[model samples]
Target chain A: MTDINFKKIIRIGLIVYFAAIALFTVGTLSRLKDGSVFGLPKFLVYGAVVLVLTVCVLLYVLHLQKRLKSGKDAFGLRVLRTIHKYRFLIEQLVTRDFKIKYKRSVLGVFWSFLNPLLMMIVQYVVFSYLLNFRGTVEHYALYLLCGIVIWNGFNDCSTQSMRSIIGNAHLITKVYVPKYIYPVTKVLSASINVLLSMVPLLLVTVIYGLIATPKLYLSFAVLLLPLALLLLLVFCIGIGFILSSLMVFFHDIEFLWTVFSTIWMYATPIIYSLEMFESRAPWLITVMQFNPMYHYINFVRSIVLYRTAPTFLEMGITALISFGTFAVGLLIFKKCQDKFVLYL
Target chain B: MNEERKLMISVQDVTMTFRREEDRSGSLKETVTKLLSRKLKFSTFTALHDVSFDVYNGDVLGIIGRNGAGKSTILKIISGIMKPTKGNIIRNGNIVPMLELGSGFDFDLSGRENIFLNGAILGYEKPYLFSKYEEIVDFSELRDFIDVPLRNYSSGMIMRLAFSIAAVVEPEILIVDEILAVGDENFQKKSRARMMELMGGGTTVLFVSHDMNQIREMCNRVIWLDGGTIRMQGETKEVCDAYRI
Candidate 1:
């Protein structure tokens, strides 16, 4: 009669993962502040803790995955049915969210195009002209454009997904679908928004004459944008799962996230460059390097703006960060989902 | 009544405890204080306690209770919408639960779109809904305005659309809430006829309602729930008279 609560166990895995990330960040930062190599005893202590935490989470994920494969639970089976066999429902939900977003609006989905273009102009005027950032940064328009779009993908998805679980309470309790699908649907809708905005990104590239400088075959770097987008989308969904689930328990996260995003936007090399902080605050540059958005934005900018492939090392690290967040996010969402009926 | 029907659903000792935030302080500051002192306060309302029941194949089991009697909670648990705090539920076949009439119906979406949306929400595949689209519309009698947004329709019209889809789906097991208490007399009659048709096709039904007369007519057996416990259960007429006394 009693079965394993995959939801509860997975959520605990998420919390452990969160602790691991925080501890790993602190450990890395401590090593940097001590001006010692990562081999310092302090780094090892932190590293061991983080390693154990990650292993625990990984083990749990594997365990649940095995159970899922064996088709053991009624609730789990029903949820799987909703996600895979009833895949049409998820598609319909995405379409419904997309359509509702543009309903009754005058400019409609074209705003996706005009929004980044207008923001690029305004940002170019302020940062390029007022601050004279162009003197320090090459092709400042394209740089700022890439940052805005990349940051927007994270920003919009996080914000929307924070509300996705609680906002759809009416439907979640009424239907027996997988509760996690709501956050996935939000991520998909946000991905579509980002997809449309990519048009202006290309237009900016054309205006700047970056495409012609390279051979046609060399332009293949541009194709790397999809891989980068896929990476970021999964990352957002991961973070979305975490934020949306936690927001149900604590009402203040939504408010806190707005402030966090503003700080995060500045923390990443979005409007400014690593050059600006080089001599004055090398530590800030080091911290920015640790930011996931820095890796993602810089990776795409390498392809689209700089006409170079992202280094393999950089690609692997970014993948780890995104996939790590997604795994943790999913764990937390499943954990918090069953109790959602009580909270909502 | 044939006594040899197979078991359609087996519910055993399902217990649901609802944690009610009673006299709780909302401020984060107070929450921190409570955390330090360990005086956080709440009360648990047991909605269903040790509830056990079963549904035979093709039987209409009517559930009756006062409002806070865990009647609706039982329906939700059996439908897998909300997992019970404690129990075992064995479902034999595919189930379609119309737990809340007009649930998952978006107000801004057209009636036709809602049919697909609601049908999908009820676990119907797209192709099946497409096959039943015209029949559902015809049954709901909304041909004149299926394209219009559902928000424009009156509550009765929405119920008509909802009932039509639920009826057309032909689920093996149907868990219905108090959906029949809506619309006019004509629609209620139509809904009853549809229920009879489902019963004829060997579809087991578990329904929750307060109408004594209707329960007597539609149900062969009835169970009375009170304060999250099964107070009485027997043949419909016998249980109804005992409940009245």
Candidate 2:
């Protein structure tokens, strides 16, 4: 913060925006009174340039801002610098979380992949055969697996991250590193588990003859899954910041979240399909649409299971939900973070 | 170049208050009920009150106080672990705190892994820690048990390990809070020598202890904090003798 260089994009945006203003000013002063001009007045020409530049610059700044968007000190170049400086600490934290999780378990990291696979197995039996349900949804295993993959990723990331800051009270009380990095570590650690679980996700798809079709295997939709995953990662980190900071003040948040998440899981169209609700209980479809998790899973399911790219409307909703929660999360964390040591 | 006498840490009118529920029930349900019934109450405990001090580069300062005299609170503030409720602290250069040795070490991790993990927690970059790896282990003198998990290591062993890791890096500022009281005499001598070496290298140290003798021996200046306020501060012997009586 004391001496930081704003990254190239922001610097460039500022420069361009100012350049436009300069052009506008110059145009305003130099009237070019000899009005044998091409269609419009000289001032009008400058105004046009200013308007165009303003639009372009505004869009560019907004895009650059999506990464660390909140504060003069909170976001932008300096925060990135601290993260870069403390990258190793974050790496070690993530490593510790991963190691501790599987430390004494008989099935260490195999459980990462196997847990979802087993859950899918049990879900397949329960949902497909026992209930004799699942109307018109093809590739039920792949469908269920995709939803589990994304939902579990969200579940683990948010759950662990919400508690991550409080869990590391010992370290925080004794050291000075960025507080947000702890939640980031949890996000990355759980994301690693989620990312690793994708192996089985792809395996199940290939095994079930889902991806054997050339168009399904080679479509551009295949590439968008990782982008979808990154969106989920950012979204969860934002929620993590909000929840972890809130939990410090309200110790009940952690327990309340447990109940809320259970309700949220049922609310999401995970085990059941949205089409069923559309056909039977259409009112629940409104709530399903509002659930961020539903939109994200629908986007991914569209790409992976159905082999069709998500529509612009779906993509926009997903991004809006993700970025909306992320911005809210950053605001909450920044506001509450300074008082953390007091509460802790 | 020639920064030896520059002011390193300046604390200006820092005050801290922690709130406690005076007649609160433990359960959220009971707390809510009492709150609705106009019975819930809280009291404020001030740990520090407008306390201010400055330490110059290459200064070895000691903080001596009786129990609950805010000695550790000052250390925590200087270390940047706790923010003051009021006032500001302007600090220069990298700071390393040795407050309560082994407080951050994960007992389940091996000593070697904990070294890296601890170094990371202290904001030491991975490459830098790896470069100082051998020296840290050697200085700890627990080389044989370096591969063993810390839970298996005795308390003294953990202290040595914590001290070695914290002191190995010659930071611009160091804060210690009574961690040397636990280890054996030989280790204590070793740690004191290392701390002196750090001072010789121009690291400003803010140390806290109840031992007046040690304060008089090592510190160039001493601040005696009592009841969350600075009772007296001057040269080492002046304040130590005043507090001892």
Candidate 3:
């Protein structure tokens, strides 16, 4: 086929792909609005979201077509191509990280499995016994474990990625690999850790469900745990991209982020129940609603602890926050990446 | 001089600038004080000043310059490690830059592992590295220490491993920056021979070196950079003789 014909076909494919997603999103949104999925306000917030997304995607596709005419791939396509091209390098880096992380440690890779469980135990004792958060949350161990696993993944991924650029100054200054690879590998390694930790999380859920509850808390809805975790992983990668880029220019961000993330962890209702804030400070609950982790943690909790699928609104919020952060973070990273070598 | 010879790399009007902070303080307190005092100072150093050059296929081009003459900056620009402050570079084919050998090596990883890791970092496919794995180990002559951690390897041993991993890749365009003098005398001769072999195999080689003898012997064409500008560029004998004087 001629180059023009090939370009035309790809342009059409792009349009069709986006159009299909828009249709699917609209169909799902209408079903959700009819209260078939889950009960909520009749307002068409999701419809508006789908429409805006469709418009944005269409605009981008148009921009991409223009670039195609000029014999250039789209920015997103170039990014994907770079990732595919350097997949081996990324794999090696992640493996290097995993190896170096566990080197000289007695337990080694098992630390990934043990760390969250240990943190949950400490928090469980502190909150359930000392702080009187026992009756406040049902299946307190499971609740605390779920929150810790998700929060730790985000914390480790972001904090480590923040240092990835500077830590690999030798490689960055000497080599021409994609700058995003460092932060991305950090997130991937952290995600692997999260996946390993989930085994223990699930084991605890099963044991706690059988002993503490009349019915098994485990349900078919727990199958959606992967989707929830995938969203959280993408969200952490996005935050990683943002923080890593910011960290390149400002050294203070490294120290500042430590304090900020600790505060952010407490801000999210990880250990405390929202009900605890309902009486003391109702406004805090309203504020916590804006926190993306609050939605993500709640989404995971709804499936694992409550044995119910998340509400359509909850799913929509999590998806929006995750993808939105990812888009923003990618843009910031790409814009600032070329200058990173200078700063480093 | 052949009409069918392709332009392997076209560097046009490329300029690189580095902004150095007068007071190198990275903390928040210093930043805040500087901000309040209104003395946030930056001095810009232009490393390359509108430099332009082109390399054709299978041409052994040597760039000769003193330190701070922007020899490394131009190589970096062509290699895509750093974006030039002005203009651009268009490179065709898979360009392998040996800017610093084993730049991505992990001290905790074994010699065998570093070979693969360093190969991948240099943009070599895993299968190719696998095929050449023994060749690399044999060339580096570190068979006994292949499984030992890199920290345990001597610096010369590390250099041999790095050079071996890098040398195996048959890139269309190879960028070398004064990394020829690696390892002890024996390994150095072996490496130089290996480099000569690579340059002989119809690859477009862009070499930067201060060694007049090496440049005179190896290069078909030479570009002399002085103060970030091409002071002279022509046949190796003409430019090298001029540069020598």
Best by DockQ: 3
Task: Give the range of the ten consecutive residues with the poorest summed lDDT in model 2 chain B.
Answer: B23-32
Off by over 4 Å in 1: A1-82, A210-218, B1-4, B24-30, B179-181, B184-188, B199-201
B124-227 in candidate 3: lDDT tens per residue? 88778899999999999999999999999899999899999989979999988874758999999999889888877889999999889988888999999999
Model 1 lDDT tens row, A1-344: 12345667578858865764664363235232342245565555656766896788687577667767787555544554445555777777788778778877899999899888888899999998898998898778888999998888789888988899888888877777778788888889888999999998887787667454332222556756777898999999999999888877777888888999999888888889999878998888667767999999998888777766566467789999999999999888888777887777
On a 0 to 100 scale, what is the lDDT of residue A116 in model 1?
Answer: 86
Q: How are the candidates ranked when ordered by DockQ, highest leading?
A: 3, 2, 1
For model 3, the interface Cα RMSD in angstroms equals: 1.2
lDDT tens per residue, model 2, A212-268 = 433344244655677688789889989999999987777788888999999998888
Q: What is the lDDT of residue A180 in candidate 1?
A: 79
Off by over 4 Å in 3: A1-80
Give residue B171's lDDT in candidate 1 (0 to 100): 82
Residue ranges of candidate 2 with Cα displaced over 4 Å: A1-75, A210-218, B1-4, B23-27, B179-185
Q: DockQ (C-alpha) of model 2?
A: 0.60
Cα deviation of A221, candidate 2, in Å: 0.6
Candidate 1: residue A279 lDDT (0-100): 93
List of chain A TM-scores, every candidate = 0.75, 0.77, 0.80
Fraction of true contacts retained by every candidate, in order, equals: 0.55, 0.68, 0.79
Q: Residues B1-245, candidate 2: write the lDDT tens digits.
A: 24557899999999988778785354467778888998878899998999999989888889988899888877888778888889899999888887767766888889998998888888786777899999999988988998888889988889889888887776778887763634798878888887767755657888887777767777889998889999999898889889879
Ranking by TM-score: 3, 2, 1
- In angstroms, the error of model 2 at A134 is 4.1
